[model samples]
Target: MTSDQYAAATRSPTDTDVERPADRSTEPAAIAVEGLTKRFGSGDDPVTAVDDVSLRIDPGSVVGLLGPNGAGKTTTIKSILGMVLPDAGTVRIQGVDVAEAPRQAYARVDAMLEGARNDYWRLTVRENLRYFATIGGVAPDSVADRHDRLLDQFGLAEKADVPVRNLSRGMKQKVSLASVLASDADVVFLDEPTLGLDVESSLTLRRELRRIVEERGLTAVISSHDMDVVEAVCDRVVIMNDGRIVADDTVANLRQGFETSAFRLTSPDLDADTLATVRDRFDVTDATTREGTTTLEVATDSDGFYELTALLRERNVTLASVATVEPDLEDVFVELTGENETGHDGGDSR
Candidate 1:
């Protein structure tokens, strides 16, 4: 980013004070949506992008929005950001109705959507940051220290004077994130923020993002396919399927329900008949054999596990190893969405 860009970023139309609503006893939610619905196309084959979705994000919390392609995640996010007009819904940002007062509602909000496209390719990194901060209702000089800190945090200080178009794809992605932070928006939406970033960069971003959110008491909604990023940064995960919310809970709670009843056992048995008997008596989810030892994954409770062991001993099978199979976020996602529907649905909703 160049100093010239910062100099040019003066007060603009977005400069408005956020007005808090009256007649409320406590602070309002950071984001509140009621009966949100959206549809595309017409005729007999109308497609519903979002279906009566209602969500509330508390202040100073990081929530993850996850879904497969065409699952209405993108549409829901757009509606909340005021980019798309919902057919039926009321969106309120920090107690301010977006429809009733968009400027005041979104005055302290920022978003980085469509990857690195949010940045100006012709502008220098520093200039882009300054311009975005200005448009977010603050003078560039007011956030100069913030811009400097963001540049250093994202390792963009060295490339600050270089035009964004001349940077690498990964560098450009960093620049986009830096610009969003420079705006100093209390409520931020980031879609695929870690896309195109290397492993180190992704880790750095996650760490910094968590620290900043906690320090500033900011509310963030992150949408990404990278489960690791979501698991690491978000306090809660909201999963959607077929335009509806299927699961909304903390990561530990989601996984805890599936952690039990899954185990891996390895044994050396006599023959095929024994394997078939074991399969018939238990739910053999997976099986593999190597070096005359068969490894089987079974889904059963504590009692069933005891029965399994008894049956194995009766068949003269010598157990080699045993371990519990822990379910991760991906496993939970597949279980809720169906394995076959985990990929794109060939729709235009997203």
Candidate 2:
């Protein structure tokens, strides 16, 4: 949906109270995509960008949309946002069907597309926030307190009067985020929100995003390649691959599903022959020796580990320590995708 549509749709008889459906508990999902399909290049060699994908996001929750390059994440997001017309299926925002009523559907939605590009470069940080609030059918003065809080929370209060173009990249990214939150939109789409931020800035953003969503009862869909950001901020994760969703669950569940197989073993009595025998019998992912102590990381289940320990005892190998390796989101992602993946989303623009 265009900015004009957003402004027009959100406008109501009372500007102070942004138009919102009542009783969210009984309303439809914050976002729902059913049987979504999109393809490019229609002839014989047509490229199916999204194939029969469906998703339902609950209200007041943060979801992470993750995928490697060419995984159709971009196309899927664009279709939901009404930027690209899908070949088939329906997209609804807060119970309003996008195809039936684009303006109403997008009225509750806002997006920050690339990093800091969402903000007007010539406008000051506070001005950008107020301008976006006005466009979302909110009077600037009505949300003046909110704008001030957002600027201060994002550490942009000092630069509130400075032009966005004069700020650093990280500061501009913060301004972009602040502008998105300035609006009264209930559902937000953030694509690579931490793209240009430093470590501290990223941390701050993650904390504030979770707080804002909880306090305002907002729903957020975050698309990012940064696993740490996703893990830190999202309540659920959806992984897409080959134009389809391959996995969807809580982060803890995803990691727990692939748990207890990887382990590290440290030994002080690993001789050359014993190490060779151990390597011959098991999958040794990493091996290192420092100051006469050898450490080996192996991937195996409990039974295989028992067998290895038996062999070590017979060969007079002394175990210094053993620890199980916990899988992180990145590890779970690689295991799910079955390959090392890198790059931006597929098609439909970055």
Error of model 2, residue 73, in angstroms: 0.7
Q: Model 2 over residues 32-132: C-alpha lDDT tens digits?
A: 99999999987789899899999988898889998877788888999999999999999989889999999999986899887226989999998999999
- The best candidate in terms of TM-score: 2
Runs of candidate 2 with Cα error greater than 4 angstroms are 1-27, 267-281, 287-295, 311-317, 341-350
Clashes of 2: 0
Model 1 global lDDT (CA atoms, 0 to 1): 0.83
TM-score of each: 0.79, 0.84
Candidate 2 CA-lDDT value: 0.85
List, residue by residue over 1-350, the lDDT tens digit for candidate 1.
12122123212233233222232226589999999999999999988989999998888889999877788999999999899999998999999999999999999999988633799999999999999998888899988998898889899999999999999988998898888888779999998888788999999999998988888888999988778888999988888878888777678666654546678999877379988998899999999999998999998888999999999888888888999888788777776666333243332246
* All-Cα superposition RMSD per candidate: 12.0, 10.3
What overall lDDT goes with each candidate model? 0.83, 0.85
Which structure among the candidates has the greatest lDDT?
2
- Least accurate 10 contiguous residues by lDDT in model 2: 1-10
